[model samples]
Target: MEQDWTAVGDALRARLDELGMTMTDLATKSGVSLTTVRELVHVLNTRRRQPRTLASLSAALGWPGEHLGSVLRGRPTSEPSGFGSLASVHSELQDLRQRVEALERAVRRTD
Candidate 1:
């Protein structure tokens, strides 16, 4: 069965409305690009699901990371279990990148 993206976008848009949020707010809160949020809103309106779409949506909504996994993948994996929100993931990713860079520099110095 094919999932309709437009409907999904619409439903997601409605959910945002119910929560008193605008696309701009979602973009800011989720740490995603405005364009991505716009596209997801469109897809949700059309009831279609994309790869990692659920993760993005859940993160934006401040809901659990696995919130929409069931709908999109039929089940959620326990892996990457702490997707509290995009802000958290973005923050953590930045920290990780910095640590990796530091490690790389140390390795180069010792080589």
Candidate 2:
């Protein structure tokens, strides 16, 4: 099967937007490096990623573990089923926490 790096990048970017998450957030959440996340998000690398890398990203994105792998292989995968509202609430809380942390850091820096 052929791999479509562009599709992977598009999906990653779109998911990040949909989650209102920055690439840094994804890297932290996925335990993946920011550099790798940037490469994937920007499609800077056309090389195939390890299954574990894709799985980590998928999990961090609140998707099925194989979601990204499927995309890489040009297979169709659906958005996560069930617990959508719960997941959204969780994601929102996480985003809010990150914002608060950033604000706190800014305040600290100004002091």
Query: Whose lDDT is greatest here?
Result: 2
Model 1 worst lDDT window (10 residues): 71-80
lDDT of 2 by residue, 1-111 (tens): 799888999999988898878999899999999999999989998786789999999889888899999999999987645654566678889878988999999999999
TM-score between candidate 2 and the true structure: 0.79
lDDT of 2 at 80: 45
TM-score on alpha carbons, each prediction: 0.49, 0.79
Off by over 4 Å in 1: 44-53, 73-111
Q: Per-residue alpha-carbon lDDT of model 1 for 11-106, expressed as tens digits?
A: 568768756677887777667678777876775244444546567776667555655554444343343455434545564566579779999999
- In order, candidate lDDTs are 0.62, 0.88
| Best prediction by TM-score | 2
lDDT, candidate 1, at 64: 56
Instruction: Evaluate model 2: give its lDDT.
Output: 0.88
Candidate 1: C-alpha RMSD to true structure equals: 9.4
Clashes in each model (backbone N, CA, C under 3 Å)?
22, 0
